[model samples]
Target: MMRKIENALAVALIAIVAVLPLFLKFMQGVCRVQVPGADIAVLHFVFLFASVAGLVTWREDRHLSLASLSSVFGEKIRRPIESVKTGGASCILSALFINAFCQLVNPAQFDARFWGMSVRFFFASLPLCYFGIIAMISCKKGNLIASLIGMVFGLFISMGPFTGILYYLFGMENVPSLYAINDAWLSFSKIALLPIIVIFSSLAFFGMPLFLVLGGIAYVLFSAGGGYVDVIPLETYRILTDRNIAAIPLFTIAGYILSQSSAGSRYVAVFKSLIGPFRGGTVIAAVIVSTFFSTFTGVSGITILALGPLLAVVLTGSGYSKDRAESLVTASGAIGLLFPPSAAIIMYATVNYFSIDVFDLFKGAIIPGCIMALSMMATGVVLDKRGERPKFSGKEARDAVLHCIPELLMPAFISVLYFKGVFDLFEAAAFAVIYAFCLSVFVRRDFTLKKSARVVASSVPVSGGVLFILGAASGISYFMLDANVPAILSGFITQYVKNPYVFLILMNLVLLVVGCLMDMFSAILIVSPLLLPLAESFGVSAVRAAVIFLMNLSIGFLTPPVGMDLFISSYTFDKPLSRVVKGILPFLIVQFAVLMLVTYVPFFTEAFL
Candidate 1:
């Protein structure tokens, strides 16, 4: 089946991506031999890895999208809407596929080959992968007519590229009629672009994949504005090939490997042994472990779901109330976003590259990140005020620390290698992957080959999904830039919200709402461009603004109603949503206080800088 093939390809690609970096590092570091075009090869593999993984994610129905409306509606009513969304997605992807193919055959496009693979192969693979997606959609939904209808619309959207292919195969003079039809379609698309975007915006709530929703809007905006829709794919290619962007997948895999191994338990043991004698020591361990896990994974939901139960037991056994423990665990999930090597900060800098420096943002985040983490721990301690606690054993502490030293040394390894200029961001990420692999597989020997495969199978989809959204959202950001939306927004903000302090407060409120609605990755991609300029207009430094943006979204994970952590914690603990919400209330208040301090004071985030 196509599904199985996609999954297999995803796993293989991820394995290669994981190993390729380590090999390259060895060639550079150990052998003192640099591989020519090594960076290019890594970026290409990352691209292929992301593409294949994204398709697998789609096949698995795991692409991130808002589906609250689907939950609200019954299956009978929701089924039709889902079918229509699928068809719409088919249309957008089909157009993109055609566009990619046209680019492949174009005389002007890049034709260089690397590692015996034509660059055109990358372009060529797009159509096949996209067509496969289309086929899989029909196969999964059993809706052939919908796909056919969608393809026709796709042709219309891709009229420019479709006609180019015709001209390249046959002279434009001979295809005068085709050119005329293309012009007519372009005119109609121009008139219809606004309405189409509106419909896609509405469909976002109806469970449309975020990539399709974003890609659709970008494609039409480009097409109607006398720009080539094919450029959207080109832009996607450009982002995926960026020097530092590959680090996202590399670091993500590293985090996944560690999470899948026995790292969490070892960390808990170490934290407990070191702090277990103090009052509220277990609560402190729970917060520390949660923060540590989330710092690597960059996904709070994963932190809560994977380690929540274990931490719950640890906390409950230490005399903490179940409600208080659950609340602390959920709130601690995302407090690590401001820490070093955080994918969120990397993404934030990448998106706002013109203004923000990755190193500066990383440095800026440390103090604020610690404040948030410590605040959560302090709140946990306060909530669980029982005085009796276990006595510390130096021998036990030494054993626990010895066991987790490699795990603890990970942060230090990354910091020394990267900050000291021994490795680039991409190389550092690759090193983290290699380090985690060795620690998990060889050092601990707890991660078996089969488990490694399973981790690859599990983590690739997440990396793919996040990368897919990042790539697609880049198109929207491109359109916004081309439209000068950021400048316009800056002018509006300058006129309306004059006070810098007032703007910071307002920005936090807005981001909290956006966080409640959108995933952090897409939010960073689509929102940062519009926000960065406004922050600058208000005299806020880029590093400080970046920290504020990320911290707000971090706390957004714990915000009420639809905060991601609330749902994950509820499910993980088997508690009602209301109970989870009630439990997290105090931690939320604490995080909000920290957020406000970071937002207003600025020194916390700017201390290192």
Candidate 2:
């Protein structure tokens, strides 16, 4: 019952937030609730979210347990409560000590009277911190009163002190609902930024969403800049408005159709029929099929899940060792990442500031992607010396091609639709969904309407989750851009690194570690923004930089200790994680070599661009 409620509330929250932009426009244009210079949209989000929190808080039958809620949040909200306690206390002390040191450095550096101001301000805000911690912890365990408190806190903080009252009381004083930015708040907020970053970063380490940290950073920076808190909501509105943005969900639905259908089998058959007669033929077929199939799913694990057993049989049966076969195929699983219409590239491009033609970006990645794919297969060909080459029959080849035509032509069809100017990306995506629907229902008949419906429904959370993160993270982008974070970051890095080669080398090493730690989606959203300016300073084009960055993270799948595909591969093959790590090491080394080459030789990507 609680699970049902949480799902319902989460779905409602996403559905409502998805359409909030239109609602905001209506309030401003038709209802006229917006003040001339103030943002009523932010207030609306505050209220709407509070309302959702209320719904999540409600117990229809007096059933209560926050465990369901915690599971619903997974790791995303788990650490915020505890971290806020320890981190908040540390923040207060650090500010006190730092302020004292600064006071000694030069009494005239700042207002000498304001030496211990940050520490004093922290004490004042300690109650709010306690309120937040209790609210989060209580929400985690499903406390009705705590959820209500959270709702109240949301309303109060969003409205601050000014906008909640004074609407009809004294309405005529130059945008009277306007909550003026307090300067003392600004100075103290700026002082608070360091501790805020450290605390949030700590939460992030515990698996909290980076967006929360980013949002906190945005709030403080916006406060310091005298900007409205509404910018976060407003940027979210802007992200949703982009035409390319709608393509994400459409393609996601389309991908699920193929992944859930017989497309994987058909793809494997086609490759086998065509290439099963050569030396190292099975290895080639496995690489090609896995690469092509994973593009639709945008998940490396799906390759292992759907085709791991078949590929394993083919490779081991072809005289390859079990560990070698498993390792090689697992490494090849992520080769789809660089292919066109891989959903993630769109996410990267959507949030990016540069102008990237999706097709053009697709064109740029072809060579780099192929290099990684070929390199994985090449390593296999060198290691495995197989003697059996099956004689190919023309009838079987024809049958296989005929069976695979729809799946095989998908990328080319979508590319033509997108690149040839025949349709907008959204239309292309819609057509892809429609095409997949036709294949799944009428031609392939892999699932009935009910099953297909479930497939589409399952994809909603993925789409919704990604969109939520994008929206929340946009606030940080706004704040960082406003705060000159990119400039400051580049300035600081160049001050120490000096050589562009050294910077590039460090970027490769650091990103490999990052990839091993976080999923690609989170890493790209959180890390890419920071890396972009630094890469540009080193004179890398956005396309090349993106390719390099993605490729490294792609290889990060083969890394140990929570690499996304490593766990999946372990489960798929019924191997323990330690064995999985050992099996994957050689292929990982080769991928790192490819990564280094891609990093240094911009020509691989540049040639296609």
Candidate 3:
């Protein structure tokens, strides 16, 4: 019953938030009237969406975490490690719940109103959902006793604020003993801060969810240093409620809607029909089609999974070797990341500490994006052993193009609408969702109502996973800024590295490792702030640094050993990991060359801006 309620509320909240921008735009432009509290409503709905969706994903065990470090071990060892990780995560969530409850019941917030609606009404979800997530995690892991003890531990640690709130609500006399306990806990936590962080870091490798790990770390740091612990949740609230952040989830839904439909096959037909007549054309078509989907899906793994099989067959049937064809598909997975309407670029501009125009960032990425895409295609062409291709069929090409015209026009539609001032970024994203919905459900009739709901339902967990990470990462970023880590690192770097070119080389190498470790969004939020200062000290423009950062990370997806693309491609193609890595080597070399060119030659990323 509780799960049903959570799901219903999550879907309703997501639906409302998803349509708000389009609804608000319709009112302003078509209805010619302002909507009261429109901005506040949108922001709060995003908050609710983030929390509820996160809670739902948490319940579903869909939140992102590193693969369990104990996966290779026996159950005897792995089970205990997993139990400890779950207990730690539950305690962290419990602490967060207590923190949010204090914020919720604050005397100042009781009278807060957005137009006629009480803000506390929405704020109520924060604590409720956090508590719910904790309960769900404990139950699923079969660690109820351990999690309960951890919850008690969390409350003990937070006793200073927790008891203070209770005293106000109950009009109790001063509790000297409770305050003493709080003080003692704080003293111990402060003294053992490094050990606690080390334990938590180890849990992260053991598969504690990333948000909980980061949030837990921030919670400890603040409490030990006598900083406000409530600010941790506030940082989450701030990042999730930002105007541009809305687009991440919105575009995410749009991407999933199209991917879940028949659009992939249609677009594949269009690309193949247009290019299949020439030598090496099948490989080129594979690259284009993969790039097109990656631009929408934002995660290249999805692109590889959705279209990898069909394209592999297409390439193999067209006479190319399976390994090379599969590698080309994997290599193309991360290419279109630098294109317009890319969620990564939007996220970079949004989270970047130094001021950056998203438009300028997108502009800067175009030539580099084209270079990466063209280079992959050219490499495939050079490596091809396929001889003369079939002659072009005008009728076949026309029909294929006509069939997928809506999919083909999607990028152009979004760009023109956003760039021409027809819609702001959020509205553009909202329009993309609505447009994809219409194409897939109404026009193409690819999804029934029930299926459409399921597709949107599936997307919520992914959106929640990404949004939750961004929110928690902001807390870590906040702690870093408060500690002045960036300035310290920047000063240290400038003193040692006398040449800008040398700094660029080291930055590139650092980002490649970082990219292999975390998702692009989290990397952008957590690392960009630290690096931007260093880049500025070396005279690299913010736009150039961003391009360099994104370009390197894109290639990082193709890096060997543990590159995400290698794993996904191996899974999709049912090939050994070694073979997948070997298959991508040629394309990886080509991308490395392009990366070096983009790093040193600024014109490709800078000329458009």
Candidate 4:
């Protein structure tokens, strides 16, 4: 019965919204109303009234006990009452006096000032929306009612008048001085509300679909009756040049195709054959294979899936335990995220407004990548030392190398292109795709047209997912700039940390925390604009700063709570997320430590530059 009611309500709501424009137009034509913005004004008022009523009802139902007010009274009830009455009466009297003074001084001024109430109401309602959602999710009583209240608040807060005030304040000259105001506003809207969305979506199961519908509605309303709100001047050549973004999808496709080819399997097989003879050898093999694959694919999920089954086979065949095999596979999987040709690296470079030569980024990453790989290998050696070591015959070793040669050549081909500069990212990626196709069709005979098409089709969703997030983040970026977020942040940072090193450390800490919660791409896109100017002020190279920022955010994939890679690893290993997290701990530590080094020691990135 409840389900049927909910569905009926949803359908009715959709129908009403769809027919609203026509209904309003008809009413206006028949009545001949002279109001220029009546539609927008009515929409705002309805939302505002709904939001206030819902919030008040919600708070009344969840009212705190009178005993809970004892702390404020402290055994002096009369005094507390006296204080409340006095404060309230004084506020009301003061408001009246101010209105009287304004009317006497200048009636036009008073009317203009009073008209600004709509803007103030709009701003005040934003926090109410956010808090209502948080309360809905976290509080125990009547989540549905609380959510409804939140929805009302969101509708009101997102109305035209509020948006207009936001545009005005943020659009002012010298608005950068109000970075704190911008930051605080964004913290409430973007940061706070986003987590609430995540929590509700995860917990309610049905919540995500509803959230998506609400989001679509909100977007439509916000964009309605728009008369060219030019928040940022578009860069002419920069926006038109698809070349800048071409590398992103091309590299993504190359990685996908490489994973689908025999190269991926062969690379896994060779590592197992070569290292299968020693104690913990299979684990070591997994690490080596992960490292090699990272050079070509630079994706942790693909690397893990490619090597996982083979590593499991080798480990079990060598008499190692399942627990040990799972640990090795999980840790090795994490290495690809930190290695070269990583999509995360591409995103970071783009967001920071500097191009990172894939070769330089790749070469610079080698040492740090090795540090992580070696750390995992060392951990495996200690963990699986007691297992029996299998010995392979000379023929077996020879065959392993022969089988692996073709797969091994792909990374070599990529490195050669990087060094020759024949393909500056986009061209190289196109070349790689062609090479992979040729290798699969003629040389390897493993890739069929059907299979190739399937592989290419599968990559679309992955690429689309990243691109969609980038677009949404662009909207959020527009909002932040409109609020003068960057200027306010710059002022705060300059006040406390004048020294470059201290500023770098502070930025690192901030990135580290942000990374743990958000995906690397979104984090870089949202954060780089704010932090890049600070880095420039401190005499830091934009390229180096970008690299460091990316490297730190990449670690988020391995951390808990929101780690996308960690979830992938858990699925690959068929282990609980907690277990996978535990296995990747050592690698996480090593990667974060390396991030600190790369951030402070500019020479690490500068050597090739």
Best by TM-score: 3
In model 4, how large is the Cα lDDT of residue 535? Answer: 81
Of the pair 1 and 3, which is ahead by lDDT? 3
> Which tens-of-lDDT digit does each residue in 1-609 have in candidate 1?
866676677777766766787788889899999888777787787788777877778777778776457777888997787678777988998888888777877878857778877777765665676777888887764677777888888887687888788767665646676677677867877999889889988888887888888888888888778756767878888888887778887887888788778998898899999997887678889888888778777778878877888888888888888888777888888977788678898888888888989999989999998998888878776776777777889999999999888899998989899999988888888888878888888889987876776776778767878888888888888888888999998998888877898898899999999888788988898898999889988889999888898988888877888887787788899988899988888878888998888888878877878
- Report lDDT (Cα) of residue 57, candidate 3: 85
Where does model 4 exceed 4 Å of error?
Answer: 1-241, 278-280, 294-298, 354-363, 478-484, 498-504
Candidate 1 steric clashes: 0
Clashes of each: 0, 1, 0, 1
What local lDDT does model 4 show for residue 492?
Answer: 82
lDDT of the candidates, in the order given: 0.82, 0.63, 0.84, 0.53
lDDT by residue (tens digit), candidate 2, 1-609? 754554454445433433444444456668988644122332233233322332332222111111112333546565456434334323322222222222223223222122223222212222232243334445454444434544443333343223322332444335523344334455666677688667656655544444344555656566556635546544654564455665655565577677678886787777777887777777888898788767766667767876788788877877788988888779888898898777667767766647455666677788999999999878877776776677988899999999888887888898886788766565566677777878888888998976776665555544544444565566777676666887898899988998888999899888888877655666676678778889988898888888888898898777777676887788789998799998888888888898888889989888966
The model with the greatest lDDT is: 3
Clashes of 3: 0
Indicate the residue-level lDDT of 205 in model 1: 82
Error of 3 at 466 (Å): 0.2
Write the candidate numbers in order of decreasing TM-score. Answer: 3, 1, 2, 4
Residue ranges of candidate 1 with Cα displaced over 4 Å: 1-8, 170-185, 188-192
lDDT by residue (106-159, candidate 3, tens digit) is 776546577688878777877887887887767774788778878988888888
Higher-TM-score candidate among 2 and 3?
3
RMSD of 4: 16.7
Query: Could you tell me the TM-score of candidate 4?
Result: 0.61
